[model samples]
Target: MIIFMQLRVNVTEFCIDFNCMKIPSSLLGFFNEIGAASRFVSRYFQEVVQPRYEVKQFIKQCFLIGYRSLPLIGITGFIMGLVLTMQLRPTLIAYGVVSKLPVMVSLAIVREIGPVISALIFAGKISSSMGAELGSMKVTEQIDAMEVSGTNPFKYLVVTRVLAATLMLPVLSVLSDAIGLYGSYLGVNIRDHTSLSLYFFEVFNTLKFGDVLPAIIKTFFFGFAIGIIGCYKGYNSSKGTEGVGRAANSAVVISSLMVFIIDLITVQITDVLGLN
Candidate 1:
């Protein structure tokens, strides 16, 4: 009983001291923002599974956010493969292991580089765009009008966009990996005489189901991070036009950060699973 009372006293004293201390405004704001975001995500899950699915809006978002973004992803993937191949060639040649070049480049691209780079690009483009578009709608009071009219704006706007992003990113990342491999093939031919069939033969031999699945799995997470953060930031935007700009800027930053965090988590999981 005495020990328990002493422990309670310590807790009460700590609470008193904590309340008495002057916390920095910036630190308080940071925690307040985190709490707000957590609430937003909780609301999302609650709303996502409810009835009346927005199929048409989801399709439209897929076309706009996914299909429209393909060319940029493809080009980036190609350049990534080409540059990587060129850079690795000299080192491999010096070690007299140039034969391992195709295997090395393909493993690197398919395993880590492609998914990450594509997701970063997606975050930069899609996240910022969602934030700005929704922020503007909020600023213009269109969201309020929708609510007044008994229209489900969150369902129409946030749900469809987030679902589209979650589904499309894996598809885009797979395509990027393929395109990067092709670019690597061309780069191989630039300095060395490697047949298309031979190059891919080596690449396919190096890549296995275990190697590819983890990379693809992480991309779904990356997309969710990009979509949810963007939607949350924009849906809650304030301060009119200034808030819209801040929402867009912060969405990109946060989405990009989330992608890296997810990727790191995936790597740790995969390593534990012996998929590394």
Candidate 2:
């Protein structure tokens, strides 16, 4: 009877542990989502390389994604530079490094703030837009129509948008940097009389290939992440109208998160390489 009791106890404990070790539905859902996204990425890569290049669509996407986005990007970049300069001036004065203001502002903008802020803005606008647009198409069965019509929907839609985003962001980032520097110049002059040439001279003098190249390189990843996530969410959207809104919202959130993660990784890499 004692031996029978021991066996029962052992069996109970083993059952308890097995139950404990089993994944909860919530965590399992999360893992399943991650796996789904991974597969989506793989599908994108596979579809992207296959022929029947959508050149016209790609150009249209570039114009829409790049040119149309400029005004917002420029305005935000200007304000960012101006606000940063105004905020930093007094602190620099306190430290007796007021003359170094241009250099400091430029470095901050170029190395980190510019790419990140620009990407977030781009993600907010573009990611959500892509998600909504694609989600709507998905819900309406336009993709299915295209498929039945013997058209390559993925290439025509996803590849063009993704490539446009990947290429355009770096250009947009460069423009934003330049505009921000101009705003910084104006900001510097607002408090004290600093010549345009002098402010730019100070800014350009301090920045090196190291600071600029890494920043540019990271923006490409930022763009790619933003585009891929947006397209993935949109292309895979389901559940009708409600899912469209969810896709747009999630795309913005995920892409913004990706931008920060990529930036952190880039900073770490540059540090390890002594670029910083």
| TM-scores, all models, native as reference | 0.93, 0.92
- Predictions in order: lDDT: 0.92, 0.91
Tens digits of per-residue lDDT for model 1, 1-276: 334445545545555578667566575566557666766776778778998888899999999999999999999999999999999999999999999999999999999999999999999999999999999999999999998998799998999999899999999999999999999999999988989999999999999998999999999999999999999899999999999999999999999999999999999999999999
lDDT of 1 at 23: 61
Overall local distance difference test of candidate 2: 0.91
Residue 183 lDDT (model 1): 99
* Model 1, backbone clash pairs (residues 3+ apart or across chains), number: 0
Worst 10 residues of 1 by lDDT: 1-10
Model 2 stretches with alpha carbons more than 4 Å out: 1-22
Clashes of each: 0, 0
